[model samples]
Target chain A: MFAEGPSVFSRFIVCLVLSFLLIVIDQRQQRLESVRATLAVVLYPIHLVVDFPTTLVRATAEKFSSRRELRAANERLRAENLELRFRMQRYQTLERENERLRALLDTSVMVGQKVLAGELLAVETTPSAHEIIINQGVRSGVFPGQPILDAEGIMGQTVHVNPFSSTAMLITDPRHALSVAVNRSGVRAIAVGTGSMAQLDLNFIPNNADIAEGDLVVSSGMDGVFPAGYPVGVIEVIEFEPTAPFARIKLRPHADLAHAREVLFVWPQTPEQDTPAAVPATEAPAP
Target chain B: MSLRNLRGTLLIGLSILIAFALTVLPLPAWAQAWRPAWVALVLMYWSMAVPERVGVITAWFIGVLLDVLVGTTLGQHALGLAVIACLTVIYHKRLRVFSQLQQGSICAGMLLLYVTLLRIVDRFAGVPVPSVSYLTVVTSALLWPWLFIILRDVRRKGGVR
Candidate 1:
């Protein structure tokens, strides 16, 4: 008498089974890459359609220009440009000194990595997940595990790469851990996400670790994911727990990741392959 | 889909678009921890309001899409979505009579529950548990009343659903 309609429990069971299958396939295999890529391509037009209203409004606003406001903006920009030029001269001198120091120390001279600009396409929709989608992806030379940076400093690493878009797992994601060094002391520690966007927990630090508030944390370049010497965070608070062996240290990220309008993807360069060592003639006699 | 039925389809599609847009909006790094779950929230609302139209399978499909979109373990979001959809289906009759504010509160709780489930799944998968952002779920719940009102208004104005 129920008209043979699918029961909610049955439907849920079906959904759970199907969703689990999809999940297993997606996680264990690379089979869904093509499907994801195709979906991204097909979805591009929809994005364009969705963004049209905002673009139209912006275009309309651009049409109604006021001369006074333009003049004010122009003057402001001119002043900022003059200030930047002065600072640039100082930076040039510092760069020369830095180069000389690097040469003397016999260390590889650090050069800025080439960056591809990207726009935020989406934030993590799951409350507990710390991630964002950017406009750049595999198509734009972006790859998974590449580090993302904002104007201030390190933002995150690319976790998922689509054809036209990539998902950046933010430093605040509980799953994220970075090998970082204290700039002042050169002591290395792993910074893990506390699930607080504002703070990170420095794990595995000894109770007597020589760290204090305001110490700058930068990438140690040990992981090969993030570049060395980029600002990651600043020590915000430290709580010493007598019962726990590790110090409960917290830090604030240098980058304003949540509100970042533009981000840069630092593409990784391929490392030189090591040559296989030749077998000693003495040991090769049996062969 | 027929032209007459197409309107409803478009409305639901637009809601998904809204979900996507909301998901992508730039927020502060500190706020990232507390950002509300968007796609699931939209799907939950729609599935409950129009269970005949949107089903558990559909919710699961959307969750998978979100998983692909967000780059999380594929089954995690799908499982969470299925759970929420089941809840929505079970409570839809009672939920339909609640005020927007009351419904929003429920939505917020459901979203929080979903997030907790996601975290549990993530932990089982060896991902670290994110700090308490239950506030985000609460805030998302707070947004439900307004979203419900606005969406209802949009539906009435568009005559699409």
Candidate 2:
């Protein structure tokens, strides 16, 4: 027990006002970013501590994995690698032909986009919150609104960046909306997050539109956030109402959206790279 | 500060760190929202036990750190936690004399208040927090008694007072 202080109420009131000021300041400006980054610096070690048990479990599991499992995995990877290499040859020829055609048409050709690998940190804020923290941050050239993807498909974009890490809001967040086009019909639709890991909704599609239940939806890149041609999800369900203006369309995302450990941060094309090329340079030897 | 007081502060700081660890602990998706407001619980316990040392200002600071950790706007948790600490301190005297069930009820009320403030701030920030996000209040109230006992034992063993 401690002595009662007369300053308790005063201290509490001051704290309340200060907190309100902080909230308003944070909402309006970037002034508090340094403060947040500094606090994140302090909290990073705690993240490591919280992440330890999972790391330990994964390490032990890796250590004791049977040789047969390893051999099977290696064999499967070898076959997959060969298959990819086989397809890549055809892709290269098509790319060269497309470039030649584009050169004739005076259309700008975009080069390769760079991707950085990052691992999800151990702690999640809450189930209700769709934000996730990853190990990449300002130090790794991570920026706010940078696109994030898993190996399978587009995940989401970064919302906040600290000195050592960043926070990303997943595509399943209720506030998230993505512009997507149906692969089968090429009819564009807006996919809105339903705040669930299992589903998203194409909220504005007309009942009589060209969309189908099984059509694969890919990012149209109209939003300028996600890259073009990345698979977003597959249309899972469609319900039509004669009186209603729009059909209720559901989607199952291509990315796991849950339990994604490794993510790729894509660096989108810069203005210089996207600008139409000058006269053709010397061509490299054929692969 | 005296050496004993320094040690006591360090002990309290260690418990806060542990609470932070629990607050962000990775649970299954179904169980994630049920994490019993660990940081808030620890802040409540300390402010109730030693109001002079861990009161409104400390709670607010911890809230700021938690916001950075959890990736919310700054001061969302700060205002909620400051109010919680304020309530605990205001009623600590009568609360200590009450039965455990009665104290638990008061804690539930405080948890509700904190969650309401959190939701208000969240809504103001345009986050689409659902009505069901109050699950933490239900879970925090249920776990308060056990957490109280554990922290009390730690305080006594460490000679914090």
Candidate 3:
């Protein structure tokens, strides 16, 4: 026995205007961010509930793993740990030497960054956006613009942070770009995401630049977002178009963007606060 | 109010929740492009079935929820779904009487409109629109018949007049 107060068309127009206002507010101003964040807290439980089934399946699979498989995995991990320890020893010596050299040159020593490990909760379901939600968020000291890395290299940056989770835009997202340098020749360039998971495009590199097909690309840290010297990607293709002024260079990202389950949130060292004083007396003579 | 009506509303709410979960379920890389717009389909179903109960305002609210869940620009889905709800309310009688196949075609058209609107919003927001996203409309349209039948059964069993 219920009839409408307003006609469907009138309601549609009202709602349409309201939605337009929302879109404009969300896009042009950051005013809606607090609302979104508050709503995200409410939405988090739904995510956890939706993910419960997958977590159950994984747990069951782990429970059913064979003894032989477990032993083999343990052995492999132990060997890997030994190898990492050996490499770490060499790295420590090199780090000390580099510090001494920096002191001699009257520059600050590189500050080590702190990292928070985060597990990927979900990948964005939209085919257009390459983003992932990680379990670390504002409560975990994650902030927007924090650089995310996998074991291999820089993966992306956090775009939004809720209380318990943050959304990270992958380096392969078309809107994302980072300043990078050729690890071999130190030629600076900007690598932009191509909207494809497999490739990133280097923008405006001259054809004469000493970029090889397999040169490593590392973050230049010029943008002040990503820390310096982390591997970003590797050059996969370099096409010289006779008509085009710039070379078309594509890169395969070093981090496994599609399949990475865990990522590192880097707390970059603030230069002014963390930089070691440039004292000449601290310099040790090179052997 | 009445227990029967409450049951009907609960059924509708449950169906929407299931649809949202399906929308977020992980698909293999190759099949990701073909994901059906589960939430849109559910919204269309309810709006068509019970315009008074599930109208443009309800569609707008659900659309915003979907937007948050999918992490898209806010109100993008609200705009699309509001239009769809309006159209469905206007043509609910005709759409109900049409053959299943004809209704499926109409569903495809609505989904295409939604996709196109979303793509335009994405362009303005500076997110890259993937060509494969168009495939979702086709997949959603193709799945309409089964979704329609299942939802209709639930409506009938719940006595949701």
The best candidate in terms of DockQ: 2
**lDDT of each residue in A1-287, candidate 1, tens digit only:** 12113587888888888766766777567687766666656555544554456556766887776888879989999999999999999988898899799889866666445789998753344556677767787878887788899989999998667787777788877778888899999888888877678988887787888989999999887766777789999998888898999888899999996678689988544334222232211100000
Give the CA lDDT, 0 to 100, for residue A176 in model 1: 81
Root-mean-square deviation of every model: 8.1, 6.4, 6.4
The residue pairs in collision within model 3 are: none
Candidate 3 per-residue lDDT over residues B78-143, each given as its tens digit: 898998998898888889999889999999999899889888877776565542388898899999
lDDT at residue B43 of model 1 (Cα atoms): 78
Worst 10 residues of 3 chain A by lDDT: A278-287
Q: What are the per-residue Cα lDDT tens digits for candidate 1 across B30-124?
A: 67666667777777777777777776878887777766655567778889988998898778878989988778878877887887987776665
lDDT of 1 at B1: 39
Best by TM-score: 2
Candidate 3 residue B97 C-alpha distance from true site, Å: 2.4
Task: Decide which is better by DockQ, 1 or 2.
Answer: 2
* lDDT tens readout by residue for model 2, B1-86: 48878888999999999988888888887787677888899999998888778899999999999888887778999899999998
Candidate 1 or 3, higher lDDT?
3
Residues forming the 10-long window of minimal summed lDDT in candidate 3 chain B: B123-132
Clashing pairs in 1: A122-B24, A123-B23, A123-B24, A258-B27, A258-B28, A258-B29, A259-B27
- Model 3 agreement with the true structure over A96-183: per-residue lDDT tens digits: 9998998899775676789999998754557667888888889999988899999999999987789988888888877788889999
The per-model lDDT (C-alpha) reads 0.74, 0.84, 0.83
